[model samples]
Target: MKIVNVVKPAIRILPMISKDEFPRMSIEDVQNNYFWGELINNQEGMYNFRKIGMNAPKDSLVLFQFDNIIIASAELLDIEKFVIPKDGKYYGAYRFDINSVKIFEPITLAEINKIDSNITAFSQVKQEINSLFMVEIQDLIKSKQMPILPDELPRQYYGKRTEGAKRQIVVNAYERNYKARQACIEHYGCRCVVCGFDFAKFYGPEFEGKIHVHHVKPLSEINESYEVDPINDLRPVCPNCHLALHSKIDGKVYDIDELKSKIKRLINN
Candidate 1:
């Protein structure tokens, strides 16, 4: 398939975490915040570079590298100096649309170097992404099936909450990480763990991969960011069971086993 762009925009590799003896957020935190709104929009951050300068201009493609792995990519929206009053310093901050960010399973630096020999290593400073590698990167981004966060419960359940507030509750309050959902589905087959409902079976082959992954840990209790162990933390649940899991009974949300028991009680009746 044809992959090269006729007039390619500049591409740059940015180290998400600095190794230059300067303290910064950990790689895990960076990865967690990438999809979460904390790192999106026009937020002041040392995302592109730690120092106060910009090499790539607006609309350039950017690869975010952390611990030698390229975890995410986004188009550079704009670059400006962001001040850190606590550090008494200013650094280059990159702003990008959250919707434009595409996350995938980590691609090692060696894999990237294999595609484009120009990149020998990652740096705290930005490295140019060559044309050959850029094509491969573009292909990878396009081909990956990144899943969206589906409403476990219908939007009507969240009455009176604005669209923006609902989204905030999804990420911050529920702590449902879409990447973790991917990992969860990868480990547990896409059949509902509680009800055994298969989307493909009921809805046809076109819906083969469609499933809502539920966070098993108590969602409302999660107030801070933490690394999710997908197998332990998530399970594949069909929309009906997902809604049941989120439903408040008397005053408490039911766990998986509790939801399963409820289903069984109805089945036996």
Candidate 2:
């Protein structure tokens, strides 16, 4: 049994626990947005600068699982050795922290082991076992299938109605519904789903929450009882894509995929 070396494009299957023994809510919060504020000593994230002269590689694949089912996926942000009372341990302490993308769908462990049994055979604590993650991720991508919007969009475009339309229906729009928006951010990642543009990466820390959140459907169409489903119903798109999302064709608004293709064609031509 060989523990794989720490390297880029690595994979780790880790489990998370909630005080109540149910981690669904935590998984929801994390999958919907970024998570990285805690530190556990002697785990995958530990103070190793003294031995390696620096923190381990910052980029790797992280999978959060519960009861043998992989619930979410995240990306390694960075590692640091510091003394901060807030973080569980200090002075050469580290924990694998991440900002993630919600899988278009949850994946089962059996399905994963079908790809390679060695992945399930990993004995170390969570955080990168080997390059096996690349295979799983590639398979997941091939099966993504979604990148599409729901069927029932309101015929009415936002902010567009006849001047003398009598009763003006003011739609309750959320440029960002705190919970829903955060989920959208986590699901699509803090990057533009259209062009894959990330503000934080390009503009630095000040632009952390600079990206926009777009509802995949009209606010009016979401009924009183209609709970906003983050995965299928919301998206985190940049301003350009947000504007382009509302672009009209022959009396129809362009969907995200269409706009993406348009951007691609523009870039290609």
CA lDDT of 184 in candidate 1? 74
Per-model lDDT: 0.64, 0.52
lDDT of 1 by residue, 127-230 (tens): 88775566787887666524444333211221122221233322333324455566678899899999999989998996887888777765445544456677
Question: What TM-score goes with each of the models?
Answer: 0.51, 0.41
Model 1 RMSD to the real structure?
Answer: 12.4
Q: Model 2 segments beyond 4 Å from truth?
A: 1-7, 20-30, 33-56, 84-100, 121-124, 127-129, 132-136, 141-175, 178-269
Top candidate on lDDT is 1
lDDT of 1: 0.64
In candidate 1, how many Å is residue 191 off? Answer: 15
Q: Best TM-score goes to which candidate?
A: 1
Candidate 1 vs. true structure, TM-score: 0.51
